[model samples]
Target: MTIPLVTVTGKSVDDKVTVERTGFEEILPKLDGNPDTSSDDSVNPLERGTELRVTVQSEVYQAWGSVFEQRIGTDVDYDPSTERVSFTLDGPPTRGPPITRAAFSPRGTGTHIGKFAGTTCYRPTGGSSCTAADVYLKSANDGFANCFTIEGDLVVERLPDSGSLYGSPGCGGAVIEGQSFFGERLSRSSAYEIKGDVTFEGYTNIRDRVELLEAGGGVHFKDDVRIDGKVKKMRGVTVDGSLYFDQGSSSNELKIGDGTVIKGDLVAHGRIKVSDTVEVHGEIYTTNRKITESGGGDGLVDETGNSKPSSEIHKSHPLSQVRGEMRRDLTHMITSDRPGRVDMSAKEPATGDPAPDLTGATLDCDADGTAETCRLGAGTYKLDHLILGHGDELELDTSGGSIKIYVEGGVEVPKNAHIQVLGNNPNQVEVYVEGQGAGSDTFHMYSGSGAGGKVTTPQDKASKFWVYMDPSDEVRLKQDTSFTGVIYGPGNAPDGDGVDIYLDKQSTVKGAVVGNFEKFTNLATVKYDATLQNKYALAAGGAARGQVAYLRTSARVVSVDS
Candidate 1:
């Protein structure tokens, strides 16, 4: 059906020229002092004139009047063939501001794992997380190499600190590490340093390599477990899972425990000792290549394959490190290069520019989302003690760019305080403290009471908020409350009995932390956001350990990164 167009008319022809507009079509105006004919096709509305004017269906459509006023660009040349639709906004659009603070990757290539640098302890109780830097958790207080008291199941992975929970394609299947700095001669294991002997209270799921340089105390599986990794320099290994031995080395004795299963071939140096059922999927390759086995339960139940030892045992294997130097072997195996541990130093947080008074002006920093809101857009703000005590909701408008807040004195956030950031990256919002010492100079964020203070964003984009304050006070990152940024409260012990950075059992920190981490009243998880390593130049303003090197090569290795 050919629908006829209805043109709304006005008496004042000069002020309002009528244009015919069908259902969602562009307006075809009568440019000249004549009405457009009914059969007239769409034509350019511009008449030869210096100024431009647009005619609508009626003078009552005043919206186009304001649209033309805010139109950007030089010329109004008409393109008759093309029709374009646009989404218009009355207010200004949001854009990240030109960053003022210096921006640089703290770790030049992010090869260091100093993300969780704790003087006392860097304890990960239950959950696991990725780290961009090498974690130096050797507690100075405790004698051992950071006593890892694993009760349930404590995990530590060497994944990228990509400010995300899932894996990334940047590293693929390869473990993220600086091999040049941590070569086999340099590093034994990848990103962990646990003292004492080896014991898998849970299931043993390992690949690559898990070195046990010293078995003076002997290895033990306190519970039912599975073993898969390549263990070295142990006196004897009793397998609960499968076993693969390099029979090509020396006459290595084999001690198979109860219910032992072998995925590959089992090659023992001396006579095989079995207490229970021994099952080998492949043939046994030993020194003499002859079948010689003894013991209780069931000897070589999978004797289905040829029971004799195969003769592939003397093809010149790298038996140097395996059997030792003919004299000092298992007893002389140094646990780990403990004496050669890389001397570590933490990145102290920026104390920010000092404040003259103990407490300054309180902000109208309350957001009710209706009449009033705290608009903390992009830009650097130097205030004295920002206390978010009033109103349940406080919103920081980060629509412009990164918001760097340098607070003097301290900051107190009470319970149920909902601080919403309008930005994405947690690095985009920073609050650096300029505390004096103890007392009012502490950073106090009271959360985890009922429903704690949640400093989240519209998307709650992983880890998205940060605060660098006095280490002597309480920055509670607890239950029902979620903050998504790095917390650097390094140096200075917590005063009398106060905790440095207290996190409750149900609390989980998205980013990393640097302080005297001791008190965790409950199970807590701190997944180090690797993206924060050099996410932005450690630009906390003042009193910060500005971009310290893990191990500087030359004195003139100054990275002129912006």
Candidate 2:
């Protein structure tokens, strides 16, 4: 439908004039000091207490005043004070339809036409304010016509089934200046873009491209997504499916969770950590580089690139010469009985011992809604201590996404309890335990036989689970428990009191184990997975860093009053 054209002339009129009509109705003031109603039968003569009914197409319009009732359709130019209606031949309204106040809350599946000066929230039911969890919109065409800035979040999701209020399932294009959340089975029909951080939670679907112009908070995708545009400037990202950054995205860090089969090229300036196995189709570029320049110099390799023997190379290379000097000093420390003399094997823990006692607030996962007796969903959990009782089976479910657990104290897994991860994809769980104080934190796994209570991830995709503990802490893997995953304890023997990792009573570790000091007793075996080195390599750079300089330099200042 075409927008009606209108024109207005004159400031005030003493007499009445005939309202004319072309192909469309035209409001002409009859200001000749007499009531003219001779030609048009639809309008009554200008007199006191007269009701005028004028219809232009199908729209019904009404204007409120003290004297008379005025009705016009489509476009009408009527001064509220003068009680006069005029028509213009101009184009569409110069500005969008003016709303009296900002912060509008629209109710359910119909179109709302106006330009909101402030925030616009969509709710399933009409209310005095917008405070609902989810809002549904069929389309955003007319509803968000000229709204360029929104000061708050735009939430669009499906209403609950029990509520009488409901809305259409999907929305059209939207450009929001604030954070956006599309949750709970809601879908976007066309391109959806946001200036702030955006999250897709609980099975929401996007039919077209989605873009984030400037997001400091990061984009978190808990479900699958196949987008057509680039995502930029996110601090970090955690994804469960194939993420294709079509235009090459940048982030400070990235975590590829389980079920992620394919990923696009990442230009990370910080770190890109993979949980399990991830197939990257594009190059992984990083800005962090150790050696900036390479050439021949004083006592180093020459530009001619001539090969030399190990003894000669060690004498010439600065780093190798330093290492040789350190080896000599260490040899003296080992042989001599000086005050600073060192023993290499002194840090290793004594054999055949259970884990240390754990003391902290108990975390009941079932009570906190994070887990049940049999199943646990993907989420980040913070706890004081972790304990799995005997004979209880707890399954970690990563089908929804990844799970990260952070403990401040210690962990205890008793005999006869089963804690296993259940998912097809690898690298779905990471457990981090920080030392509470000196000699207080420890990781203990009890020994048992014949269906013993063992804690383990999937054996085939053992690299998916990563356990990182403090350097001063002790980790004890008791008898009859087969562990599969990477164990990382950070510290060094000469520099500090290093970590102690003990494997006892025929326990086997399928993945690699790295600690400051490790001991194996009673036929325990550690079959290191050499391929894990390449899988979890600290490559050039992982995800691209945020372009803060570019964003600041590119922004233009505009007057808010204008």
Best candidate according to lDDT: 2
**Can you write out model 2's per-residue Cα lDDT over 410-507, one digit (the tens) per residue?**
77666666668777764356666764642443777775544444657654454556666666688887777766666655343322333566665666
Indicate the worst ten consecutive residues by lDDT in candidate 2. 544-553
Per-residue lDDT of 448 in model 1: 45
Q: Write the per-residue lDDT of candidate 1 for residues 1-562, one digit (tens) a residue.
A: 0113244443444544444423342244432222122336424332221122323333433443335334532122233233322222211111111111111111111212111111111222234543233332212121112112222222222222221111112222112121101111122334222112444433333222333322233233332222222333232233343333433334544445544455444543333455445566544544433344455555555545444233422223334532331111111211121111011122222333222221233445533233234555655566655666533565666554556676665665556666677755333666766554436426554454456655665443423465655444546555545565566554422112222565554455555555444443333454444444443324332211111111111111211211
Q: Estimate each model's TM-score.
A: 0.42, 0.31
Q: Would you list the C-alpha lDDT of every candidate in the order shown? A: 0.37, 0.38
Best by TM-score: 1
Q: How many clashes in each candidate?
A: 16, 23
Which sections of candidate 1 miss by over 4 Å? 1-256, 265-275, 282-295, 299-361, 364-373, 383-387, 408-412, 424-427, 434-449, 462-464, 469-475, 489-502, 512-562
Rate residue 474 of model 2 by lDDT. 80
